[model samples]
Target: MSHPILTEKTVLLNANVKNKEEAVRLAGQLLVDQGCVEPSYIDRMLEREQSLSTYIGNSVAIPHGTEKGKKNILRSGISILQIPGGVDFGDGQMAKILIGIAGKGNEHMEILSKIALVCAEEENVSKMIHARSKGELFSLFDGVN
Candidate 1:
């Protein structure tokens, strides 16, 4: 990314979430704590999930707020949840990585594009999914964005 959308604090490793909804909320809350978005943003994120699937393959799912929920955004930022056992993102798509994003404008697409680009390579995605530490995750993303 031209600027960082995610940081070490925004990444969760071996997180404990029962399902997709829980995962989204956990990731969204991280963004909220970071001052990136309002608490309401998580509701909008779930709304998006209901209307359209965010699953981007490679066991990754990108969840973002709906157009109506844009008002809740305070800044452009991204949060990542790494689930070692994977979560079912509906439709039989097992998502091992759940990224919750709240962008304050066109930054939304920019962040999504960056993540998509990085995850486009199966090898890179695998590295990210299996990264043992925050430093390792940062190293994987630093090379691409």
Candidate 2:
């Protein structure tokens, strides 16, 4: 069974973010701005992105990796950034939704999988892209099982 780490409440729909680098940076900043993560966390994420493009298929890109901890840490967040020009995901697809998942160990995968499933849905994706507020974004994720 998978749990949702990213609730719609945390999602920012149609964000003005543009480009992959900006998307990752914005996601990290949101985490810090919301007091959900440490400032240094962004650097770690940037390092990871430099290694490879974290853009997955389906116009969705999940940029995440394990933190520097031995045990599991359940720190996860989601932000829906709408790139009007579309960011290159290295897969020849422009990404509009940036789902950032950060944590330690494997527990976060469950939530990540849930986000993946929700994003994979055509109806959900359209609604998510058109989402207006944090509340509406959260509503899209409601009852997602």
Candidate 3:
């Protein structure tokens, strides 16, 4: 069986998280639940955050595993977490949208670029943050990449 990169089941809306770590865990958990990656991948995601912030500005953050975490990836997957309340990503950067990614092989680069493009627009980020339903959020990501 094959899974789509972004599924409704993986898109969480109105998530309330205390901090970036908790946010990353929620996003990573979605990918794991979807059979996209191993359980250990979440740790690497945290490690990556510690090394460098994934907060890309415009109220968006993209969290992905380190190079070593690649081994834990079962397939390419993207998880979206809509945090309307927002979480502090350190350095005064509060991210309202958290995108967790697990890509197989060289697919991560492509996924990153596509996500970057979508997130670059402030309007799109606002739409994602305020999306009332999973379907609404899914529509924002439709045809992405």
Best by lDDT: 3
Model 1, position 78, has a per-residue lDDT of 83
Q: Measure candidate 1: CA RMSD.
A: 2.2
TM-score of 3: 0.97
Off by over 4 Å in 1: 1-3, 143-145
Q: What are the root-mean-square deviations of the candidates from the true structure over C-alphas?
A: 2.2, 3.9, 1.0
lDDT (10s digit) by residue, model 3, range 53-144: 99999999999999999999999999999999899999889999999999899999988888988898888899998899999889877765
**Sequence-dependent TM-score of model 2:** 0.76
Model 2 is weakest, by summed lDDT over 10 consecutive residues, at: 65-74
Candidate whose TM-score is highest: 3
Over 4 Å off, model 3: none
Off by over 4 Å in 2: 1-9, 66-74, 104-106, 143-145
**Candidate 2, 1-145: lDDT as tens digits:** 3434555444665566546777888876666555446667767667778787777666767776435521223354544555545678765777777776665455466767777778878787666666667776677666532
User: lDDT per model, in order?
Assistant: 0.85, 0.63, 0.93
TM-score of each model, in listed order = 0.93, 0.76, 0.97
Screening candidate 1 with a backbone cut-off below 3 angstroms (N, C-alpha, C), the clashing residue pairs are: 1-145
